[model samples]
Target: MFRFFRWFRDFRRNRNHTLSSSPQPSDKARSPCNQPIVEATPSWKFDSKARWSKEYDLSICHAEDDIIYVENLVSYLELQPHSLRCFLQIRDSVPGGAMSTELCQAVRESHCWILIISPSFLKDPWCWYQMQQALSESPTANGRVIPVRKQLERKDYPQELRFMYGIDVRLDKDNGFLKIKQAILYYLEELCAKDREEQQQRDSENLVDEATPQA
Candidate 1:
């Protein structure tokens, strides 16, 4: 009877020891936050002009009569960080005889187009062409076109522009300028968000390719 009891006790002890010594499943491995760590890509360090010389943050399209106002606007924009590389015909020294192919290309490359509307501006055919091209490139009016009314009423503007909200600099120059700056900043923020999403997707694809087995 004593031997049988001792054997039973030893069996229980051995079983318990074996169970404790065996490796158990870890919760850490099941946690998503602890799995599949990915390293971030290093940021490219280069001058913005060197990286995107042909592209511009904003393009100002206006008639020769409004050059002074455009210059003032450019000066104000230059105070901002990313607005240093604005495209303007006068500043760029585009050929004065006629609108060249380079000029049109510049307008297309611009992320945002600002039109200074005035009596003279309406008289110029080239200005109208620029407006048409900008609208075609960015169909979403809220995203691209920024019109600054100098001495025109909403009714006097084109039917297409009449419905769109524009900054009226004729009445209040300061407030209108501020609104233009705010619009540029808003558009730039949207562009940056899009770039970040595209970069993340590229990184995830690269990681999957790296983990795939070779045949």
Candidate 2:
């Protein structure tokens, strides 16, 4: 009986020792935040041609009478080091019947829309349609629809555009044009900053996932 009791005690001690010495899961393995990680799939291959076609930076909407002024503005924009690509209706000649479709698509694709406001601008049906399309595409505004007033008063402005401030070209041509250029650059900077932040966040998440050990 003495020998049996000693054996039993020894067995119990050995079992307890084994239990205490067993490896515990690491903090990362037991983390509640740990989830099945999924790597982002690339949308296009490295050498895709779609990369070559850049989106237009701006789309200009104006009446036929404002063509000369719009051309001059386009020329000025082209001269800048960070020259913005603009989509002018006259420059992109779609078939007569397809004008509406093309204009809507251009507004949707463009980062910003510049409306040259004048009496003729208000009088034109096509200009009104383009304005509506631009507004619809950019519901949040966010410096998308920039109105360049030409001999038009605040009261004369459309009800929808009245709340927003505009550049009055008639007041001083050079200054107004410079302001427009600066505004375009400002918006571009904002877009680039947003993209960089998003990319950084994505990269951070990817690194965390890659470092985490799987069960």
Candidate 3:
């Protein structure tokens, strides 16, 4: 009995330490344990007995250093095994800025870009560059580009990027966060759909090219 109680206390302390230390944005500090969203939603969206499982999977990137926002978004989505590996423009330990080649590789490798956009983000060259990179690589949902807004308007977006869709996250708060997560999931599903379309298009093109006599 005493032994079990001691073990439980130690286990909880260890978890607290482990979670607090993981390299994340400073917003995490402000995100209280009893955030308003937590009360509105259940303790765990899934089973209390079975381990909770969240379905939204997105390769996220943070633009406005929304670490708490990112954290809460993933939490509500019930991200399992943490599929979304979110990044700020630069990690705290690293001294140098991420270059074009690095950005290219990240955009190419990642399935989606969940950028937190605000007036500040629009002004930053790197964020715009990252958005452009996503546009050049996988322009649609497969290689998706999502802008989660803080207080910016869609109309203000550069004309070149007007066509792309973004996750609407303004004063809506955590519900806004949930909407962003859901949007990512929708895009991921679209990615699966687009894959089939891309394959068929390639097949048709190949047949047409093959059928034509060699020059």
In terms of TM-score, which candidate is strongest?
2
Model 3 lDDT tens row, 86-108: 33334311233336655665566
- What lDDT score is found at residue 84 in candidate 1? 39
Q: Which residue segments of model 1 deviate by more than 4 Å?
A: 1-54, 95-98, 171-175
The per-residue C-alpha lDDT of model 2 at residue 33 equals: 21
Q: If the candidates were sorted by their TM-score against the true structure, best first, what order would they fall in? A: 2, 1, 3
TM-score on alpha carbons, each prediction? 0.69, 0.73, 0.52
On the 0 to 100 scale, the lDDT of residue 88 in model 2 is: 70
Residue 205, candidate 2: how far off, in angstroms?
0.5
118-161: candidate 2 lDDT, tens digit per residue: 99999999999999998888776689889889978778899888
lDDT tens digits by residue: candidate 1, 1-215: 64564466446544644553344343212211122212122223212232353367788889999887787776556441233357777545333334566567767778788989888888999889888888888777776799888888777787667767888986663636656766876666566656666777989999999999988
Error of 2 at 163 (Å): 1.6
TM-score-superior candidate, 2 or 3: 2
Candidate 1 or 3, higher lDDT?
1
- What lDDT does each candidate get? 0.66, 0.69, 0.54
Could you arrange the candidates by lDDT from highest to lowest?
Answer: 2, 1, 3
